[model samples]
Target: MADMSLGPGLGSSDTCRSAARQAGAPRVLLVIPCFNEEASIGGLLNEIAAIGRGYHTLVVDDGSSDATCTVASCRSPVARLAQNLGIGGAVQTGIKYAARQDFDFCIQIDGDGQHDPRAIEKLLDAYRSHPTNITIGSRFIDHSGFCSTPMRRAGIRLIVLALNGLFTGGRITDPTSGMRLLDRSAIAFFARSYPADFPEPISLAWAMRAGLTVSEVPVEMRARKAGVSSIDGIKSASYMIRVLGYILLARLVRAP
Candidate 1:
């Protein structure tokens, strides 16, 4: 049997101790942006809680017109949004909350199951050690166990390659991977001006423009357990175009 007693402050004893172990390591917030993701949210939250690290999860329920809010609310400390804010806004909401609450770092994760909770430790390890540069979970680094459609994989590779050339002047390997860890500097940066739509790509460029160091760490990706992707096929093409245009626009603006 699982520990039904687990919720927010109750199980965070382990996380608090773990946080103490690192001495200077930032307090971590695992931010999940959800839209009608009740099926996977509960399991995902429990899995992350099982990590035994002092990690708190915030589910920015983006106006999920389903059991998502109800189910999430039953759990402890899961935040919710009153209106559909889309992915970008949902994530930004969580980020802002994390910043305001004075968390040391925030890990942006998809509410869908495409991101593996187990890989979180690897990203955290990198972030803890580096203490600089944003750590992104890249699914294309080794490609040993990740599963995705061929077309989507190809599209991601192309986008990653282009992103490397255009922004980082280096290869990203997984440009669209939603799993990422941001330090306090990054957390503050984005809390002020996160992209409103399709933020993963645009935010990368924005981080770079702010002279924040960025790096990718290898992580195996998973297929979503339920719910259709917000972006696919033709949507990917449109997203690429829109982000590319936004990148150019962003470059024109002087850094704050």
Candidate 2:
């Protein structure tokens, strides 16, 4: 209702990363959106550390009524929001912080434990190969790991069809995938303006419309170990329609 905002065995990462980034690698920041993810978060933090030494992590607790806030406080600097602003708001907050931190690139990972921290290599590798600003970790490209449920898969396919058929000049295999990496320019763009609802696909179309380089890399993901999906069967159809309307309608009326 109000406006927004990790681990012990982890000492402050600054002491560890200050040396790592001295090798000339761009500073990387991980933005994790959490809502009642207490069951899966603690273990995920451990995995994140294993990704690399220089990577910094920030957990935005979206007004959860559970122990999510307390659990993440020990590991990372948590932005506990005053009220629930949804996942989009949480990510915007993180990106804004990333911009202030002077991060060279930022990656958005899910707290539900659905995204694999290890696949970050492929995302980074893709970034290195192009002048791209956004690299999304796509599940369908390799058809690896869990690709979500049948109903949601159908919805995602429909959205992709629409993107290729009408909007988003170039094709993006998994617009709805939350596992994405953003370079400096993208961090600036997102820090200034981001979609308020269902940001994945809408933001992808918006970025493409704005003429930013966007690419996708194949990745493996796992089924959620805890917490429920934001979209359920009852709302999937309507959710799909709302997102489509937002993307198509918003673009049509923008004053060039």
Q: Top TM-score: which candidate number?
A: 2
What lDDT would candidate 1 get against the real structure?
0.75
* Lowest summed lDDT window (length 10), candidate 2: 4-13
Residue-wise C-alpha lDDT for candidate 2, range 1-256, written one tens digit per residue: 3564323322335654576568677778889989999999888888988766557888989889999988888677788888888998889888988887777889999999999888877888888887588999999998989998888888898888766665644568898999999999899888888988889988877777777778888999999999788798969888888878877775686512
lDDT of predicted model 2: 0.82
Give the clashing pairs for model 1.
15-53, 15-54
True-structure Cα RMSD, model 1: 5.6
Compared with the true structure, what per-residue lDDT tens digits does model 1 show for residues 1-256? 1111122442346566566657875577888888999998888877777777757788777877888766766663666666776788888877887777777789988888778888888988887676555788987778766647787776666666556666653356766778999888888999898887668877887888777888888888777888888678888677777766776776777533
- Give residue 15's lDDT in candidate 1 (0 to 100): 62
Question: Once superposed on the true structure, which residue ranges of model 1 sit more than 4 Å away at CA?
Answer: 1-25, 254-256
Runs in model 2 lying further than 4 Å from the true structure: 1-22
